[model samples]
Target: MKKLVLLLIVLVFACKNETKIIEKPIEAVKAKAKPTTKFILETLKSKGFKTFDYVDTKTKDTVIMQQYFIAFLKSGPIRNQNEEESTLLQEQHLAHLGKMYDLGYADISGPFGDDGDIRGITIYNVPTLKMADSLANSDPMVKSGRLQIEVHPWWAAKGFSLR
Candidate 1:
């Protein structure tokens, strides 16, 4: 009985100290653990952006930066079209926007659901406000005096990108 008791204690200690590893392929493990931010950074890098670089700052610290511009579309009071004409103009406007998107002149755009004067917003990849205005003015809606644009520059830290 004493020998049986000793064997049980030895077995318990051996099992408690044992190390178990459920083997998984390294690639599988990595795929499961990969960060979304890493994928976003890689996507941004693929987009021809200088995602990470040091810049001298007034605060005596080098800073990493990324830049973009946003254009705000505001409703205009100059629409002289009836309901049917307005619908046709809207179609033309959408077609013009699709062409710009295909040309990569506009990044992303969407309309607002509010009843305010603000109509829509578009984020542009153009370098200057003049370029942004040119793109905005090229829109059929703007040319027809149905919309106006207000553009602003936006900046962010490196590795932070819209996915």
Candidate 2:
């Protein structure tokens, strides 16, 4: 009976030691893990994105700001396309916008609700105004003179979503 008790105690100690060993590695992994914000900032910087960080006084949280380009699609000189041509050009323009989103070049795009000089807007995620302008001009509507592009640099908080 005494020998059995000794064996059981030894087994318990062995189990405890194994648990401690496992717990140490888990803690080490946690300690080594980087915060998501830091990782994102580093990635953006590495990709040549212009960024700055600030602490929000209200929330006491760090906010990362990134420079993005906003392209305004305006009415161009040529607006006299035939009905079918106009429809086809519109389809091609939408397809171009979709490709931009899929390629991660453009974040969001939408047309205005009412008739206006500014027809729509596309927020480009690219780092440079030149790149954004080029992409915007590549739209079929712009290429065919149905639309014009005016690009400007805009700054916004990174990781923010439209509510």
Candidate 3:
């Protein structure tokens, strides 16, 4: 009977120790896991993106700023296309913009509601001005002389969304 009790006690202790061992590794994994902001910054850095960090004075929160390119779509010298040709070029232009967004090159693109020289804007997420210019100039509207591209380097906080 004493041996049986001793065996039971040993089993209980063994189980308890096993549980502690398993739990420790889990805690270690939790500790090693990176926060979302850190992961984002690391990913941006890995991709060769130009980034800087700053602390907001009011909130004391770290903000990650990245260099982005903004392409201004302006009225080109030639706009004498017929209605059909113009419509086709407009459709192609929209498709190109959509492709850029899908490929993670452009973040947002939209046309202005006014009749002005600056017809619209596209914010490219690429790291270089040259790349942004190439993508913007590839638009069918630009190729057809219905629009022109003027690219400029812009900076904005990463992981932000438009309200």
Candidate 4:
């Protein structure tokens, strides 16, 4: 992977009783380059992904595209459920996610390693954030207060995949 240093600027404007906020990335400044990992490159190649150009709908800028919808599952305010009930809820969560995977709503779902606050993530195949939220809200973990989900929409080139 190439190292890129991006400079971001935030602009705020006030007009009468309204406020507008804008954030823009100015340019990419190259950092120290490192050798590309062969294992990762080989793994990606095995998944049938190829480089392709993608144009941002909002900015109209073109760039290489490889993306997915990432749902960040964070720790919620409620986590006082008993062990027995928590076990059952976990079962339901897995079952619900398994069904979603089988039905093609979710492409990948897993936990982050020992990360605080942020618990896990789900990569959905859906195009819009609304659809991703609908699917995420169906998780038992999210419903039972064990986790809260935040959804992000992502896009990638056609033929992108993982093993």
Who wins the TM-score comparison? 2
After superposing all C-alphas onto the true structure, candidate 3 shows an RMSD in angstroms of: 3.9
Off-target runs (Cα >4 Å) in candidate 1 are: 1-64, 156-163
Q: What overall lDDT, based on C-alpha atoms, would model 3 receive against the true structure?
A: 0.94
Best of the two (1, 3) by lDDT: 3
Relative to the unseen true structure, what is the C-alpha lDDT of residue 62 in candidate 3, on a scale of 0 to 100?
A: 90
Lowest summed lDDT across 10 adjacent residues in model 2 is found at 32-41
Q: Score each candidate by Cα lDDT.
A: 0.74, 0.96, 0.94, 0.71
Per-residue lDDT of model 1, residues 1-163, tens digit only: 9999999999987776552232345556877884555565567667654445454566654455545567888988787889997998899888877877788777678899997889998877655667878888888888888888888876666444576
Off by over 4 Å in 4: 1-67
Give the range where candidate 3 is weakest over 10 consecutive residues by summed lDDT.
34-43
lDDT of 2: 0.96
Writing each residue's lDDT as its tens digit, candidate 2 over 71-95 gives 9999999999999999999999999
Best-first order by TM-score = 2, 3, 4, 1
Clash pairs detected, candidate 1: none
Write the residue-wise lDDT of candidate 4 on 1-163 in tens digits.
Answer: 1222222211222332143222212122223343244444455456543334656799885545544577899998789999999999889988988998999778889888996999988887665567779899889989988899888767665444675
**In candidate 3, which residue ranges exceed 4 Å CA deviation?**
1-39
Against the hidden reference, what TM-scores do the models get?
0.57, 0.82, 0.80, 0.58
Best by lDDT: 2
